[model samples]
Target: MTSRNRSTRVSILSALIGATLAVPAAFAGQVDTAGIQSDGSYARLVVKYRDSARLRTAAADRVAETIAGAAARAGIAGGVARGGAALPLSASRLRATASQADVVRLSRALDANQTQALLRQIAADPSVEFVQVDRRLTHTRLPDVRPMLVPNDNYYQQYQWHLHDAIGGIGAESAWETSTGEGVVVAVLDTGITAHPDMDANMLEGYDFITDAFVSRRDSDERVPGAADLGDWNPVANECYAGSPVTDSSWHGTHTAGTVAELTDNATGMAGVAHDAKVLPVRVLGRCGGYTSDIADAIVWASGGEVDGVPTNASPAEVINMSLGGGGACDTLTQDAINGAVSRGTVVVVAAGNQGQDAANHSPASCANVINVGATGITGIKAYYSNYGNLVDLSAPGGGVTDGNPDGYVWQAINSGATVPEDPTYGGMAGTSMAAPHVAGIVALIQSAVEVPKTPAEIEAILKESARAFASAPSQPMGAGIVDAPAALALALDGGGEEPCEPGEPGCEEEPPIDSTPITSGQVVTGLSGVAGTEGLYRIEVPAGMRNLNVLTYGGTGDVSVYVSRGSEPGADEHDWASTRPGTNETVRVANPEAGVYYVKVVGESLYARVNLQARYN
Candidate 1:
């Protein structure tokens, strides 16, 4: 394989796959509707009231009335001024959010400026906790192109190269021999999953949480049971926003769920990564895009949390696959929901976006406690449209047919209808949306393979340690490496196999014992150097009451990695936090670290010189 010129390869690719592939660098003849404006364009607000006995015990109607009064006092009653014209501000009532009763969703006709002003005024009320715009999120899928040369024979062994290909696959076939993800549940939160013979059996009863009538295309603004695809087809261009194009309903949830748990060994169509795992389809996205508030509620509900009006999830998922994303920092509502899910032992996996830019600019992808997955092609190189940055945790096969690799798209089950449900068939699609589920399925495999379930942090550490090296150095940083399913399963079964010395254990020297170097807080060491096979160790004493522990290595040159652990020796495979970006720049942050002696290890992936290392806490 040869490398292509990155500067010249930014163009729309429309061969092999009939649909025009939207490359991140360019979109020709069509607008990439997936790109959303992060600021001042929203028409809704999410307000969370402060937690108090009075607020908690108040009636839902009473709470709604209080929120309404606050909004009215904020000068949000009349028409909103935009572009020298006043837009009608509908008399909207506040509705309690399903996930948390204290939180409410307010919809009205307002431009960006009025929304911001209203939010500020509402937040000033003593009864209010926090308020922000209800941002919109869209599925991360690029177009799926039906391959012309698909054989009439078994597609699993022939076309599903991403599952078993040694260079680009997740080694799902090998891992299947040990674990088929039995008894594990995974939640796919995208456009609702449709009825497909290939994946129907594995799907549990789901709910449609889209509350807006226009977005849901339903009779009224109400969240109903049963997660079904209502066809997010846009008949008219610009219906979603200014310049948004007309498009067909992408059965996105069904495609992603098929990749996660579609039936295998049935002598049938395709093989899913975790063929035996149960899928809990959660519908949050719809026409245009779903509101961030709705997606947040689904996250909490799918993880066995209590939603105000929804039934309890009898079978809460052990893992969540969010193949959807949008721009901006993670909102407070979404973060709170994710925090709740992680605390309940659910591992969240999200797409690194298809922007071909820094992933830090995207939400959920940049959110904490999530496994941010980037896309890799059959050649084991980063996909051209995949978002790349230090925040990306790993890479998986999301296909790259448009990047001069004509046959690298991921094949899976899809609907045949252009605007609604039809016959079940197979097709090839590409994007970080596809990449995320591969990792999510692998996580299920790991969970099933182990005798005991691991914590989110432990599972993450295992994945990073077991990832496969890229075929060659990538042009940009794409996480630790491509995810290796077999390696990750083996690591988990072996209990992560690290024998770090714990604090208060005998033979654990308090001082720097000859082999290690001692460093102090707020200290910076420069001119550090190492070879490919060499290792550098440093230790620091963290006191109590410090809010954060930060160990960073940057400046100078060469490829270096930083690993940190509390009260134990850190290494490549044994550390609480690991930062292994491509270059010398690396950072490991530990929140509310315990008071103890922490170990830091710096290892070179290649020959290195003149590196700087620092340790600080506050």
Candidate 2:
């Protein structure tokens, strides 16, 4: 491709795929041809048939005979057919990748009437349940025009104040050295990623966990075998009658993956935050919305599978990116499954949701172990659609429709073949979904930069503390602040000053202690204290109207606990320890008590504690 063309392709892919954090898995040979539309020239066929309980011997011979007869009568260059238990019928499609001239010749040869007759004959065959012209590819094109890399001057000035004089300029090279994310795998749980030129080189093994085969194959049968290296594009299966069959729409995963690590500075397309990181495409959402159960299973499998009879994923992912969420109370089962993954060293990142409502209005995003992300515009202003709350860990560039900012929106391409609007370079879009991957990609970069591997908690801390704070931030609900890739990577390599804390020991004199005086009804008293010899521990009285209470601390190597009692005294302590070493805060919920004084204590075995207390009223 020419430089200009390559640039356009890169820009388009970058905007669509963006950064992701997860592992790729070996591709399963499942042929999913969901997007193929019926056109006059050719018809895509889905054949359904019953497989007998007998061995493959009978079916194999029958399919072989049929193939030989078909090949003898007509000119067939290449095609695939196989027999397997999962396959419903002996199915194969006659396809040709021809140029425009070749297409014209082929169309004339088949003729309109001849083509109709051929389709009828094929459909009439008992083995073939369906046959229709494949037309989805006809309209495919490189996007016609480039997207606005930076918003128009008017949009930038009037509404996009966040990007105005932001620290990083467009294409501003980071002083921090580039690092390799080659081995780390990021699993993107979203709408499927369309195959694009920019992603071909860096894309790794991935499977469609949404399918019945529990593999990445999109087709239900192994009747046809194709290339091994290519990933499967399975649409989510329809569970309800009202739900449409799975089809690729927004190309959400592709965009997120490109951002996380899109073969940066390869003299072709846009640079990714961690260009070397490998992306694992895990399809979760399809037509309308994905199910909570499927999402839960995807999480388990992505983080190394085998959660309650769901097959153990063939490949384990180090990080999983979930850019989808639904409204509901956080499910305990889901939370436990996530925690199980975290305990296994898989970092889970979730979108805070795009509703612009409180995060408590959502689920998995509201789960404790996951890193909940909110959205900021190109100019650094919070996107109108970004969901926020104390649950949000940080924010990143999630493009906005109304306001425009350099940082407020990402400039990248949409999948031209998918239903989403296709733009060459940049299109304005917004969501916590866009913001979550920014952090996931940053995590990949940090993992690449650091010598000693950081735990998920430590990685989260570096990102949160190193974020760029917006001067006019709307609320603390936005979390620490917008993500800063360079700053976060720098902190990661520098170790972020993490150390062990001990009980009753004079806390880090340098680090501020968590001190609270007023300690009101619904407010938490928070501070960081050093643990000297033993783990750090602290106690406070839970005031009235405080229905729940918990503690948060950093720089400890052991378990932590939160104790609560109706009276101003310690009861049986509820120990909620960190699952990993070099841990960050631990929270415990306490039931509301009668109007009277109550005690809340935080203790860490063998370390000092930097504590942040939080309380919610009944």
Candidate 3:
């Protein structure tokens, strides 16, 4: 399709917000959590009331009373909105119409040790719906210092090996055949982007959440218009902070933005992972990093929430790309905001911290419900500096600058100058930061597929399930393997699996005598037994390292049999595991099974039995 034709289709679909936000029903009541400081105190607490509508409709007196009641219930003598005190409305510079009167500020008199108790008391009160600790986060990328060859697009292909390299790349070419992320909006929250020839047209007006004038390096105290990169250089004469050394601006956000949706086929610069997708360039980082409060507000606003003190975002993102982070754990503040974004249908892709240690120690990455990405080098091994352990959900090419070759670095658009008159140029950087945008770009492609919008959980499942297995496992496990954009897209569009099979001994009239549905872990399939003595058959493709496979049947008055078989066909010797007995629930769990397709049989012992079968693999 031509550009003009595709543009119209995108406009029509733009209204389909959070088209893919599928999360487990069990997590609904829990507050999104993140890292905790050792000081026994999270800098802040995000208190959400039982009703969101109250923020907009409640009168001043009522709002004030609600705040007072919550604080008093928590036994806070000072550290909160006191009764009859002038209300301190939670506000952000960008959200002009937002009402933060619902958020009660903790009093300064309270010590960090007193927080947990007060928080518990506040939480026990029925008035509070959700609360999270305000944790700190820093940019996940570190420092480094790319052109090369490719097919068609005469741009910076040689330097962008991470985009097409067979060793560790996502195979951008094949994935582009299906989608260019035409209608998707990917929000980048970082130091911000500068004017770059390759990415200007793809940019959206974003807010500056860095409220400190010194850190913002701007004349104003609050947020302003376009998301421009005002050099982050901390000169020697004016150190960014006490004991901080002067350094050059990284233009970190600009580089990540370039990787996600920089203009492609235009042939002026490198092709982006999702060329046609729009970028919502959010500025959340600045000199000496940024505050967690500012970052949290950006996450809320980016997901289309009414963040107090800031205007509602005109273009809410379907995928939020956060390449920046600090260490600790998943802080409650960041986690809660992330949950809000995910709840609104946004797929958040975060960089595993650059620290070469267990990723479980990192925030957001370890937080619930987000896709945490690790970095791999051109050799397809975990990058030396990339975080490892179970927390990493997947891995991507973040470049290996020290692999004895400059070619290993992922290259993209940036400004060479340290501070002002932006000079559009290209360079290479190596970190988990570079890996995240790759996933974000692919997420845009997945979201823009003709198939239905996928929830964050579904999207993660697809990306992990479809990843190309590494030739050999890394020293540390890095998810299922490197992300395979083409494979992930194909699986995503397939819509989980084929329809379920009808009840019968053979289940079908075919020669195989079985019709199976494609199944991923955590998927539940329901079917009717039709009549007594008949059975419902299903097939599951269990990936490698899947240590547990459990099949359970629930509901129906009649007796039902549940069994797991080793092959595609259910036979006499095929039963590797079985749970037989009459009752409402029957379960069979296999601790170890050969990596291959497994068949599940649900037998009905009575007339018209309604059975719900679910398969779980981990």
Highest TM-score: which candidate? Answer: 1
Q: Write the per-residue lDDT of candidate 3 for residues 1-618, one digit (tens) a residue.
A: 000000000000001011111233332223433443444343345555565555565544443454445456545555234566644322111222122413333444244544554455445545555455544455776653433222234545566778888877899999999999999999999888888778899999898887667767889767887777787777784353235666778888888999999888886768899999999999988776776677878888888987766778999999999887765566555666888899999999999888888776776676667788999877777888888866677889888734545556887877777766356777677889999999999999988985678888678878876887665677775676889999889988887422234446465542353576666667776656567678677888776566667778787667776666655455323454667676648887665444567787777666645667788888
Error of 1 at 477 (Å): 2.9
Total colliding residue pairs, candidate 1 = 1
Tell me each candidate's TM-score: 0.77, 0.52, 0.67
- What is the Cα-based lDDT of residue 20 in candidate 2? 19
Per-residue alpha-carbon lDDT of candidate 1 for residues 284-339, written as tens digits (9 for 90 to 100):
99899898888999999999888877889999999999999888666667777888
lDDT score at residue 395, model 1, on the 0-100 scale? 90
Candidate lDDT scores, in order, read 0.77, 0.49, 0.70
- Name every residue pair that clashes in candidate 1: 206-227
In Å, residue 617's CA in model 1 sits off its true spot by 7.0
10 residues in a row with least lDDT, candidate 1 = 6-15
Count of clashes in candidate 3: 30
Sort order, TM-score high to low: 1, 3, 2
Off by over 4 Å in 3: 1-36, 39-133, 144-155, 236-244, 497-618
